[model samples]
Target: MKNKTYVLVIIALITLSFSSMAQRVDRTNFKAGVHAGVPFGDISDLANFEIGLDLGYHWALSELIDAGLSTGFMNVFVNNDTVDFGSFVLEGDFPNIQYLPVAAALRIYPTYDFKLGADVGYAVGVNQGNSGGLYIRPMVGVNVGRSTEVNISYVKISDDYDFSMAALGILFLF
Candidate 1:
């Protein structure tokens, strides 16, 4: 009888501990960051680099998962290249390409401080004649304190022209 009672107490304690841990993580959070990107593929031929800012809000779905909304602005700087305008050759610096991306974000935590995340949505063009369309980003990050993280990600925007970049950033959580 004493052995059975001890086992039951141990089971109760374990259950309570799990419940407390779940409660601790089921909360809302906001994160913001800035990133610098290196262009790749065809984009590299036209754009030298990219810089961006991101903001997001997340609702904890479980201890290991979160769903959120994210929005950001990215600017791709044009390279100095000459474009043949058919009648003449146009040279000098071109206008920078800009995008405003809005996305649905999801994050999964495999460990306490490590996470994998993805965002999918649309990037709206800010410049006339610049077409923007689908936007996607996949990232991996490690949390460095209660409210800070460092991340590396790949971002893609597909439209009349497609662009891809590798980005590294820091995020602050609140």
Candidate 2:
């Protein structure tokens, strides 16, 4: 009976130690960045370029995966030369179109310094008569340091008018 009790206690101690070692620390982060976007396809005929800000909050789900929420503002400038009013050419630079994008973001880290990510969301137009639509962005990046990363991404928005852009950006994570 004494030998059996000692074995059971030793097993319990080993089980407890393994369970503790298997636990990982949870982490949360915030990231923000700015990007320059070049329009493509039919959008290139109307828009010259885009400038945007991105902000997000993410929580680590595992050693290699993160899930988050992201929101951002983007402005797409219209090409003045492309604007034709039939009777006369539109004179001034047209008002810049704006979008507010809200999305669910996911990222997977293949290496300590490399990651691939995607954001799926809706782009809401801030201007009257400007129809908002579905927004999708897929990106790849490398961490430059402990707190900064550089990324390149493609963004697509679909609505009454479909448009897409390619962007390069830098983000600070905290």
> For model 2, which pairs clash?
none
Summed over model 2, clashes come to 0
The TM-score, computed over Cα atoms with residue i paired to residue i, of candidate 2 is: 0.80
Per-model TM-score, in order, reads 0.81, 0.80
Q: Which pairs clash (backbone N, Cα, C closer than 3 Å) in model 1?
A: none
lDDT of each residue in 51-128, candidate 1, tens digit only: 999999987776788899999899998888975545766688788989999999999989869999999999999977
- Stretches of model 2 off by over 4 angstroms after superposition: 1-28, 84-93
lDDT of 2 by residue, 1-174 (tens): 999999999999988765643441233389999999998866776787899999999877666778999999999988776455456555665677789999999999888699999999999988777788999999999999988989999999997766899999999987
Q: Pick the candidate with the highest TM-score.
A: 1
